[model samples]
Target: MSHLVIDIGNSRTKIAIFDDHKLVKNDVLEDLTEEKLRDYLKENSIQQSIISSVRDGIERLENVLIEQTVYIRFSAALNTNINNQYKSPETLGLDRLAGVIGAKALYPGENCLVIDLGTCITYDAIDNDNVYKGGSISPGLNMRLRAMHELTGRLPLIPLDDFDGSEGNNTGTSMLSGVVNGTFLEMAGFIEQYRAQYSELRVILCGGDANFFDTRLKNSIFAHTLKTEPDLVLIGLNEVINQQ
Candidate 1:
């Protein structure tokens, strides 16, 4: 049976179909509602499914999904492999929870660093013992760029392009360099910090900015090549649902 997994993020919602542990179709949608979700599910032969949301609006969508299949929502708890060291667990973004779950599910019995570079940059670590240690969060690429433009009067809002090795020449290019390079350095710095604490660290990068960082920082200190899996959170949500 094919499983429909939906991941509701801050900016968009991602839907995917996983057939017997293999992802078949995946797409991101801006309008996440009962009608749109129903249409997507009807297009596929899904009998069971899961939904995980970081930005809310799941009640209506869940009602629709339940009419056709067994719909489950991913939630946080102490039972999950990761520990909730944060002051308040409920406040932790569901996307981050899904990323950590996905990392643990994808790379079991290993020390993996899951970095999600989306609206916000999140670094979650799962140690060799299958213990989920918390990670850190920082402003993302666009956030930095927007901050430069909004917080200052002279700085122009610059758009970032695909990463093509680190040197920039013009004003826009200079902003791009600072945002991208600063992000890369931040990631590298964190990875290095983790390495000092954890002997063997396996890194996995995901999200919109993952490619940019992966392409530019692969050789420097990132031990592995860039592995971009857009539907990681969805898959992780499915895993959480299956368990329940």
Candidate 2:
């Protein structure tokens, strides 16, 4: 049987097709219209669909999925293995759940740190015990740059790009240093802290900026002895939806 998984985020929506637990195809789109989405679904032999959306257009997408398949799973807050140390569990984002699911499935029997670098950079932890302990979230690369520009009068809204090295020379470069470099350090520091706590910690990085960060900081312990799964969230959503 085939499975379809869609993750609707703040900036973009990702669609993936899975045959059973194995991924068949994946795509990222800026606009998600039901008509276009339905046309894509026609190509896949989908028997079920799992959707995780932070946006409001999912009701329409749900109708499209229902038109194609009988089983349509929409992720929501639940008494899951993931510990909700956060004040409000319902407020937690669905993308985080997808990342955690990916970590659990891809790196079973290991303690994993899942970092997603989309509009908001999120860190989630799944321990060796299979307990999903919550992690942290911070402004993403683009958001940080935009925040600097919006909050101040002089700072310009710069694009999200990594400097070749740790240092940046010019003002624009300095902004990159403060935002992108700082983000890399933040990730490295978090991984270091986790490593101190758990000897068997394994790191997995995903999202749009993950490749840039991974390429620049692959020498760090977290990046060196780690895995980068770009389609981790899609895979996770597929796995969870299939379970139901």
Candidate 3:
């Protein structure tokens, strides 16, 4: 049977079609409309649908999903085989929980660290006991750059491009180094810290910036443990669907 999963985030939305847990189609779109959902349902024999949205005002999208297929509303309370120990279960990001769920599916009983790098970078950890004690969240690459531009009078909004390495000679390059390289180093540091605590830690990277961070960290000290799973959230969302 076919299942559809959609993750609605701050900047964009991701839609994935899974054929009994095997991903069949995935797409990222800036605008999510009823027509798009209709088209997807129209093109495929989607049997069930699930959605996890971080942004509010998705009542319309929810309506469309309910209309299209046997919709399953994904949330933290869904019957997933994991222990969610977050202090504020109501406030916990479903995306974060989804990442943790994805990591659990990959590692099963082992400790897992999920670093989702998107509009904002989020770190989530689930222990070998399947207990999830939330991680940290920080500004992502573009958000950092944008903050420098909007928050400061001097820093200009610089487009993301190749980082030239050397501490950057000019203002723009310096911003690039601090924004991009800084993020890499920050992730490296997190990996280092988590690895120190959890010896059998399996690091899973996801979100829009996962590939870039994954490639950049390949030669780092934590390379052996780090894994880049771009479709992680979708996988977790699918897990939620199947578990139910």
Candidate 4:
């Protein structure tokens, strides 16, 4: 039997199946329909399913999961083994909380700094005391590019990939440098600031942009390495099921 974990985000949907505590399958879906989900569940020997969604329109999928398998609604109330000290628990994103729990589960007794780079880059860190102190959120790389285009009168939305540490020659390259390279610097600064306070901090970088940054950040080879887990949220969703 397998446990199905679904993370519905603003742009993409992540589906992961865990046979016991081990992940057996992982998928990223851009176009998700009820029939598609039903067909998937029917094919798998799913024991239970849990969903952590950021946006609406998941109610229909929720019904499909309920009819197909044992459905568990992931909420902040779930036993994550970490004390929640955030001022506003209700407004906290389920994905963010889950990321921290995922970090805590993987690196126990150590202070973990979770930097999730997705639609939004979230900085969530749980201290050695297992207390979930709130962190910061900023516009992700794509979001920065989109914002520039939307806000400016002439700047076009450009694909960001290359950066050579220099201010780009043209408008397009300039945008990439500012968005991608700027974000890189911002992440390094955030890690340094946190490490200054928590000397033994274990950094966990996850989400869609993790690999891009992971490869780029390793070039510096700082005193401590940044740990990248592209499927941290999926692993954490499975952890939520295990907690029960």
Candidate 5:
């Protein structure tokens, strides 16, 4: 049977088609409409559907999924075998929880650190014992750049493409270096701290900026323990369907 998983995030929506446990197709779109969802359902023989959204006003999409398939509204209460110990489970981002679940699903009994680089960079950890205590969240690459421009009068917003990953000689380059390189150092520092606790920690990178961070970290000492799975949230959502 086929399953459809959708993750609605701040900037984009991710749709994945899973044939049982294997992901057969994945697509990222800026916006997802009911008509577009209908096209997917028409093209594939989807038996079940699950959605995890970070925003509101999705009732129309929900109605379509509810009418068409066995729609599962993803929330913190859904059991995916992880022992969640977050203080505010209801307030925890479903995407973050899904990332942790994705880590567990991918690594099984291994200690995993999932770093999602999207509108905001989130760090979530799941121990080998299947326990999730908490994680961290920081401004993402673009957010940092935009913040610099918005918060300060002198700074201009630097584009990610303009950054060549080098020491800055000019104002724009300096801002880019500080944001991109600084963020990398921040990530490295977090990894170091997590490694101190879990020596066998497996770092999984996902979200829009996953490839960029993967490229940077691959050149560093963390290459051996690093993994990039852009479809991680979708994978975790699929796992939820399987567990049901």
Candidate 6:
């Protein structure tokens, strides 16, 4: 059966069509409309649909999906065989939960650490036994740059494209070094700590900034174990459908 998964994140909306375990089509959009969704449904014979949205205001789209297909309302409460040990499951981000679920689905019988680099950086871990004990969250690259710029008087908002990973030669370069390089170091440090605990840890990177970190980490010590899946949330949502 074909599955349609939608992940509505803080900055972008990702939609994917899966033919069972294989991803057939994927798209990233600034906004998902009823017309656009209808177009997709018309083009594909989607049987099951799942959606994970970090924001609100998608009721119309949800209604259309509900009426047209077997819609799965993804939530922290969904039973996907994950031993969720989070203190507050209701407060957990569905994206984060789906991320670890995706990790487990992709790398079964192994310890997985999922680092999503988007509006925020989230580090979630799932053990070989599918036990999710929760993880950490921090400011993302853009958030760090914007914080420095908005919080201070002289620090300019340096674009992420300007990051060169070099020692600061000027004010802009310095900010770039601080945000980009700092974030890289922070990620490396998190991976190192997680590796220490889970000796057989597999790191999965996703989200808008996944490519940036994947490029930087390819030469680092974590390269062998690191895998980037920009469509991880979509994959995870599809996994949910499979389980159902």
Q: How many residue pairs clash in each candidate?
A: 0, 0, 0, 0, 0, 0
Name the runs in model 1 displaced over 4 angstroms.
78-87, 162-166
Query: What do the candidate models score in CA lDDT, each in turn?
Result: 0.77, 0.80, 0.86, 0.86, 0.92, 0.92
Q: In order, what is each prediction's RMSD in angstroms? A: 2.1, 2.0, 1.3, 1.6, 0.9, 1.0
TM-score of 1: 0.91
Global fold similarity of model 2 (TM-score): 0.92
Model 3, 44-157: lDDT tens digits are 888898888998888887888787689987777777898887888889898999989888887888889999998999989899999987899999888988898999888889
Name the weakest run of 10 consecutive residues (lDDT summed) in model 6: 157-166
Q: How many Å off is the CA of 204 in candidate 1?
A: 0.5
Report residue 141 deviation for candidate 2 (angstroms): 0.4
Task: Give model 5 RMSD, 1 decimal.
Answer: 0.9
Could you tell me which 10 consecutive residues in candidate 2 have the lowest summed lDDT? 75-84
> How would you order the candidates by TM-score, starting with the best?
5, 6, 3, 4, 2, 1
Winning model by lDDT: 5
Model 6 alpha-carbon miss at residue 7, Å: 0.5
- Name the TM-score of candidate 4: 0.94
Model 1 C-alpha lDDT per residue in residues 69-153, reported as the tens digit of each score: 8876556663566654655677777788788778778877778778898989999877877666477989999999999999998
Q: Write the per-residue lDDT of candidate 4 for residues 36-55, one digit (tens) a residue.
A: 89889878888899999899
